[model samples]
Target chain A: MASARLPNLGAGNYFGLGELYAAWKNPEIQEMALHTSLSALGYVDILRVPAPILEEHVFPFMETPTSTTMEIAGTPVADDALMEWAVEERFVNATRVMVIDLDRCVRCDDCVRACASTHGGNPRFRRHGRTFDSMMVANACMHCADPVCMIGCPTGAIHRSVEHGTVIINDITCIGCATCANSCPYNNISMVAIRNPDGATITDPDSGKPIFKATKCDFCDGQPGGPACVRACPHDALKRVHFQELNPAGMAT
Target chain B: MIRRSALPFIVIGIATFAVVAWYARFTWLELGNPSIVTGYTLLVLMLMLGFFNIRKRLSMVPVGRTSLLLAFHVAAGLLAIALFWLHTGTLWPTGSYERILAVLFYLVSLTGILGYIILRSLPRRLTQTGIEVVYERIPAELGEIREKVEALTLECTEKTGSDTVAQHYIGTLNWFFRRPRFGLSHLVGGDAAGHWLRGPGGAARRYLNDVEKEYFDQILELGTLKILVDRHYACQDLMKKWLLVHVPLSMAVILVSIWHLLLVNVYAI
Candidate 1:
């Protein structure tokens, strides 16, 4: 594996004066020093590393120091070094969630037609919306790595699940403010006009106005077959992408 | 208050509006009328807002705001195509505007797909991390103090001349049990230079210069540690911005798509 570039602080030193001065004044430095003195006297923190060094490097390491070591390219290195090496180059990796095979699309409008049917005539919810010449693609969410929508979600309704890595909007938490819609980079999500299962428009009970909730294709997580559009498409034109399969060598893969 | 970041939104807005107007001309989609004009207006609004969401790097937006906007843009695009199809009532019509718009819409959608792929896969390749520092906690002053203690030990050792058990205890206690024991890692890791060789106090022995050299290296190591922290922060920020370019363009394409969709629906025979 290619080694990650270590931050160079030598002849090519890059930090500005302001940052250096700030570090010179960091309170944590003083605290760390005191802790180091204490640890030297044999008081151990949960980790065996001395307190001061542990505190300063805690954010970077984010892991316990293991005495265990392994050979890497014929070099016997400590476990902590190997773990840091693994995540050195890549930060937050993103996985592809949806794919549209333009080659397979018959333009039968089944996906769009199915989405419209599912959403009750609001064609705004289609898997593929079109342009003057060709078809347009649609889906509620791309589940992006940098979810701009989550930035301004006032009620914290929209969130990227840490476990599955899917961005989900908690309906009960959403206030139907449309902030997510306004901030959406692709406009895939919308403040859809909501209704009861029976097809009548759901309205605010107190305000007596039609209720709107942010809605989108959730890949039909709870459904047995997965995403409604993927399952509903007769042509198999759409599939949730797992980008890892596309680029085996890429970090996410 | 508008910055360079807001430029994409404005450009996307005007371009989408113009496309809608042009599409209206080629198709009988009531180019000069109210509902169609309103729809076109919304397309511009959507495009501008979508672009801003990305360029500003609004951290508070939901995780998939860019993706959502693209999806909505696609839907709006389809409506535009549907309107155009309604006007022409047939596909494969030999009209220049119609053909150009059709191809352009396809291109935009294709680019949008590619942008999504880039956004999803890139950041993982760019995780910025700092070096492994084992003694960043030691303040410059305290580290210097520890250096003095080590220097005293070395000086005292040389003065006493005999490497006795009592001498070793005194040296170890003076070096590790001094006012601050923070620099021991530097001592163990050989990073403390020869500061420990000089023994405690400013009183210089023959090896005092070597102890000073160790103190100097400690100063350099501390600086290197800070530089790593800043670099890590910078790389993370850069990775976030890269997504801005890839994701916002999806919105612009979506805006153009609306006009494309309307024209297709109106003009298709």
Candidate 2:
């Protein structure tokens, strides 16, 4: 856990512009891992943290004085629900994942469509997801700290990139067992029918059934810029955020 | 603010068109074929604008960001419309061969503008729906709603010795519950489903006793959910399917524009 990245990550999002510039200014922490745990900053996974430990360290942040929904003016669905859901669903299990500013998102499938274009014409995520007002936890892979999708991979085809923690599935080794698809609780992974050069579905010879492959967002692997979805959003709505930071911000319900 | 924003593209597009328009105007004054310069210019602009599709395909490459490309594509498209008018000097072309090309061009522009509007406005409206459903999953969600409605209809019959609610399901509500209904209505914000639920749905409730009314109330709640899902279906359906028209027509515009170019060079030019 590179603790030097905490103040840079907290309060302001890692994807947020000022934070990126600030991070770049500090060369020592520039090479921090995508999901750098903040234990050195005196915080661990929120799920595992005991109350007294969190109270002394993290509780100060939670004391925003604003309560849930109507109590703080009633328009919100409660920031607590957002945090609780993130903690319970393990959305923050990843260091960084796509989050949407619904206030900004125009429901343009540009992000989703751009993702598909990057990954051989099959979109890796759904724009549709759990929403709390203008914030959406879009159903894209967070490339979790512990990818549950990796549990049943018979061939060990789905693996994390050593360079960046992007979860990539090797198309060649993948057997289309659909283990990852079923195991993914968020339904981020989809089993798309494997197609050939002429746009015909490749069939399993013995079974004579259309072969499938487990597909999801690979964080635009090997691409120069970054995730195409974030780059594709004209509205500046979509962001690849540290889910750990999102919990305290309480953007979703 | 201007440099980082799409203002540059807009500024650049206008400046280039103004330069070309000025050049074409001088050529026209000299009684020369201004169509050649404006036509060629429009063709080049179309190629640049049309390359957005190609850019979409080449996402693996490091050309530029797709969002910026789209913003530029749109700015370029609008300027091309100006150049289009400058080239032809008329909105409608009289020549039969040119008319087909003109029609195709207008269709492309119309669809593109419509798509721009859809992409701009649809997302916010979708968020207002308070639920996010995948486009493909709408049918299954509808099916789930249908199942619940039918079960409620059945419960109405069983709990009370009344088939009025069941009869209502069979008669009026059945059609609404079947598949996506009133798509055009939803598209136009007609709220036909909501109106039906409130109007005819209320009318049907009058026939029910307290026990049956309880069942109807639950059915109405399910109907409301169905309406939201249908709204998602209509909007998402429009978002994806409009590309079917816009993309192919865009490609056609390219093909026809090429043929028109060859014809102008060989015969007219």
Task: Name the candidate that leads on DockQ.
Answer: 2
Native contacts retained by model 1, as a fraction?
A: 0.00
TM-score of model 2 vs. true structure: 0.71
Error of 2 at A88 (Å): 5.5
For residues B181-250, could you state the per-residue lDDT of candidate 2 as single tens digits? 7677777777788987899766798877899989999989988998888888887889778989999998
Any runs in candidate 2 off by more than 4 Å, and if so which? Answer: A1-90, A101-128, A144-161, A165-217, A231-237, A244-253, B1-5, B26-32
Q: Compute the lDDT of residue B26 as modeled in candidate 1.
A: 54
| TM-score for each predicted model, relative to the true structure | 0.29, 0.71
Local error of candidate 2 at B12, Å? 0.9
Report i-RMS for every model: 16.8, 2.8
CAPRI level of candidate 2:
acceptable
Model 1 agreement with the true structure over B42-152: per-residue lDDT tens digits: 456446535533522332222332333444444444444444443444555476765664565445545544443433332222222213111232245445544654565
List the per-model TM-score of the A chain. 0.51, 0.67
